[model samples]
Target: MLKVIFLAAFAVGTVLADGELIILNNPGSVHFEGSQATNQSFLKEVFTVVLGYTPKLTQPWDGVEIRDPFLLPEALVSIVIEGVESVKSPRGKHFPLNVDEVEEVTWQAVSRRLEERDTNNTLVRIRVGDGLDALGQSALGELKPNSVDPASLKHLSLNNEEDQKFIEELQLLRAIAQKIPSTVTANSKPDVYWFVVSGLRPVMDLHGKDSEATKEALKLLNDAVNDLSNAFTDIYNGQVVVALFTNDANKLRNTRSVESPRVRREEKAGELETFDAAAQNSSDNLNTIEKPITLRLSKRYSANYPVIFNIFLWFGIVFFFSLLAICIAIAGMDPGRDSIIYRMTSNRMKKDN
Candidate 1:
């Protein structure tokens, strides 16, 4: 009987490891009560503790920032922009000048880009301690990594009507991580995994108004996060990341007088399905207001001139003056510069030769 049970478990693990990567957001959106800078700092400090070193922001992007050495590389980032199909993965570390808002860069788009690059073109790289030393070189070459079927990702939420079983989210995440390749070898192309569970601490006083239950629930959540973090470190070997995406507000509502019903996990799952369907269907419709004509021009750069100042400013000015002078000189000619030219009657006329 024991042997049969062991085999069943092993079979489950085998199937998961061969499946697609799953990324799911924990139930609800919650943020600490604070400014944007404070939230960012708090997040950084948490990661510093986890990673054993502070991670430097790849770019200090405003509105939305995705910081990680392993996930999205610069070359393939263009696939996140407008006309994703036409944008080939180009060389160099050039960030897209214009990109859709982070929220707009849906998981569908990310999955699509990965599908196109799945032909042994995917590169896995890591940088330790935000330093120049790469944990693995991001060399683009033909490398037969494991094949991953594209899958959709979802952001789950738990409202007042939910059980708020955020801890279970971690358990689900563990199952997903188990699906990843157990080991990375020279010939084995493996991928890293992470979960961004947003909406932990709501600005609204969810448990206020002497509602002892919700308050206790909040306290329980704290214990869960710490316990899970320690477990992930030991079990996953610190390869998978658990990121709690949150923001804080200055003022929180005093809901001591309000009694909001908590939601159960089962109901939340159903809601998540509905939410996922709605988000996918309701993505901002992109209309091409101006028909774009693809124009090919030599990639040009200017030395010692800022792009906002227009590096070609001086060149254009010089060009204009030179052009005008030539045009004026020709027009000022007796007839025309390119007209039938007669020899000057006075090369030696002054000398009367």
Candidate 2:
């Protein structure tokens, strides 16, 4: 059954997509290549765990063709996961300060540095599960369970073994979908939404690929992905963009698949391929990146005193300071050899005094 999410629109226009950002995790070690992610035939085989199955009639398919051909599959994680933040050098000195005194590290604050197009925070953050923190887990070994102490890093390590992580994650996303505002027609803030879902288990499983224990543990991954994809669509009505990828390293590798990223600003639902698992390592280039219909840039020059209006103001200040300095020097001028005030107020120094 398709679960529907309902929201009343306040504005009177055709409600459509402002855009959406979905971040889902897949196995780092899998190689899901050469899978038909076309809407016509995606269910032929198991790619990764799974997510919502989308209809292809409205959404066409395009595979992202990575230009490289000599990259190793296992190294895709390092290449595909966005590394703009981690690769940056930290502030020269580090002193733990109060929360407000510290810099804003939220996704919205870092969105610019992350190269996000929208800096207005229109992409509402939809955090599904709270275990490993940060919706965008850029690196592996981030498989940690939710902690009670908040500050305590030590907890039941996910070690990427728990199926419950993915299960609870899907559940939370479904529940959260019903709560957020999906009406993007109004000219308001929070125009878009963002969801980050990570499935770090199956591939990171300690057991070997053929091990029954691993298979039993990862059986539900497919169901989770399928359901989440559908639920978001049912709620948003296909007015979203989903870009699924494995690692940022994949971009550097010889991997590529074309995806139907939203280009013309149309309304509809679609699914990009999920994070490629080893068994069905199916990583296709989902086109969450859509070019804007129109782009206008407004520039603001940072100058305290422009040569235009403020120049006089600064010039006046400098002129007064210079005049005052000269006056002070004149007032302090010496005896009979100079001004009347100096002659009256000052006396010749006694010899050797």
Candidate 3:
């Protein structure tokens, strides 16, 4: 019954795919050449394990073509036991159950454990059995007992070795999938087609170089190309021609140059308006910058400044100083015999002083 419930959750397909594939390699932080192949089949498998089960195997199946395979068969058979329920054995019930009852009990345990996903009123907790840490090991070298620490989850580790093994197995599956060739007909088919299409109609990056990150950055690039290649032979696939390489050094210089123009315009904003009017007042300013003209010079020239007066400027400066000198002299004059006006002013000024 537990196996039946587990199998029901996953749907596996072993059909040959008419889809595109993309294989990316970033092993040890180094990229390698990308490959393309045609005519591949995709296989899916599913299984289940109890929470306490150990020594479980995860492996690949036989009688299938695995392209760029990354996993082995022996690893697949391991059982992955995820904790499904937190229950004290019923009526103090211990282990040693019959095969007929195993399925029903396993399912009951799973349903109980699954209750945690639905509970929203309070903080959810998982009972970590024993002293397992993040690396899935008990205190020292011993295995943790079948007990959960709901509060000490931070210190708790997954003791499920089967799950870890399965993850590694999945990587192998992905590698093999990359090696297979599939057809790309529509956007929903696969991502490999996009990568191939980008190669044909290359787009230049901002720095006038082929984009290094575009193939990796854009998801559609890979799907469109791989799928299209799979759909038809003789279509370009599996080739990574450089579309753009960012020149960081040149970009930095351009960023610095961008600031100068902004600064010049801001500083000259109001000052240039006055300068332009003065330049227009005198043709000499325009003459400074050489210009070709077809018009002949006239013998007669008009002087417009003859009507504008220069005398008022000089007279105004003189009058201002004269009034200032008079005020200072009067302020220094004696109060006794200056005049009646002085006397009246002196009397009032002295009283206020």
Candidate 4:
């Protein structure tokens, strides 16, 4: 038994050391809750397999709330990771979060976006966060070891004051946007377009409620979008991308309540079916893509290393046991050598004769 166990462990280790990469996209539909959930699942799996990390997947609301803002807070993250594809193994793992920051606003915004009547036709929201830094954080922690300044640790923060400053900037931009001359004639032959991005806190309480922190946060986001748009106008031709991120009173209501219960139920059923099909198709496409891609440590950094490690470990064990069985069979079938008991019995038989 001891020999068998050792052999098994060795076999398992070898397989894991040589795993493969898998890619998955974020959810793009209203019914599917975007790709955030898939992203989290991929993260948990990869971290477990590669680095022996065990991160949990929480509900979007709970997960969003606990996330650190300054770290890389996007509503959706795209993950890529290496995982086993054996008959008895977990399907795959991926690392998609571009920024590790919480998606507090994005969650609510997604909810609102999905609930709208014309949601199906809306342009897919594409968001990108700090990319290289985001990947580093996902692989390890936020520590720049090779920095010339030794005190870099003191300034290094996964979540820091920068988020607040950015939020404030967003509000100021919104203010500037409101002031921008709306009279600028729409460009008939626009050469360049302006794009704006902004964000804000959630919406809670409507009556006589007055919370300075919340109000100020919202204003900052509003201004940020507006100002960013204005800047684009100044730089570009007559037209600009009119993009903005905000926590407006109406923005939070991206999802609307269903009026008729029957219709609502039917719509939900249809949406669910569509989302399921889309998810299946997306997964299949990813699998096709991963065939040519080599798996590496960087690829599977977000996975829980131990879990992944154990899978290969099991495979090794199975292989070892198989070898042990072969050895035992050979030992049992050695017809050339007689056993000691058999030899002694044969000598006694000759003496008796």
Say which candidate scores most in TM-score: 2
C-alpha lDDT of residue 307 in model 1 = 57
Q: Model 4, 130-209: lDDT tens per residue? A: 22232243211232322123232232222435333333333333433343344123322212111222222222132112
Reference-based lDDT, each prediction:
0.28, 0.30, 0.24, 0.28
Candidate 3 Cα deviation (angstroms), residue 116: 89
How do the residues 1-353 of candidate 1 rate in per-residue lDDT, one tens digit apiece?
Answer: 43353245334433322111111111111111211121221232222222222223222223223343222211111111111111112211112221111211223233333333344423332111111122122232222222212231022234443323333333332332342333322222222222333223321244442355444434443343445344434443444333322211111111110111111122332211222232233322211101121342112222222554565887898999999999998767774333443234334323344
Residue ranges of candidate 2 with Cα displaced over 4 Å: 1-121, 125-129, 132-161, 178-192, 202-204, 212-219, 248-353
- Residues 224-251 of candidate 3: C-alpha lDDT, one tens digit per residue: 2233223232222322111111111112
Residue range 89-198, candidate 2, lDDT tens digits: 11111111111100111222223322333354333444344443444442222233323232321222344445456445644544443333343332211133344444
Please say which candidate is ahead in lDDT: 2 or 4.
2
**Per-model C-alpha RMSD:** 20.9, 22.3, 37.4, 24.4
lDDT for predicted candidate 2 compared with the true structure: 0.30
Taking all chains together, each candidate's TM-score versus the true structure is: 0.28, 0.29, 0.13, 0.22
How close to the true structure is residue 336 of candidate 4, measured as C-alpha lDDT? 35
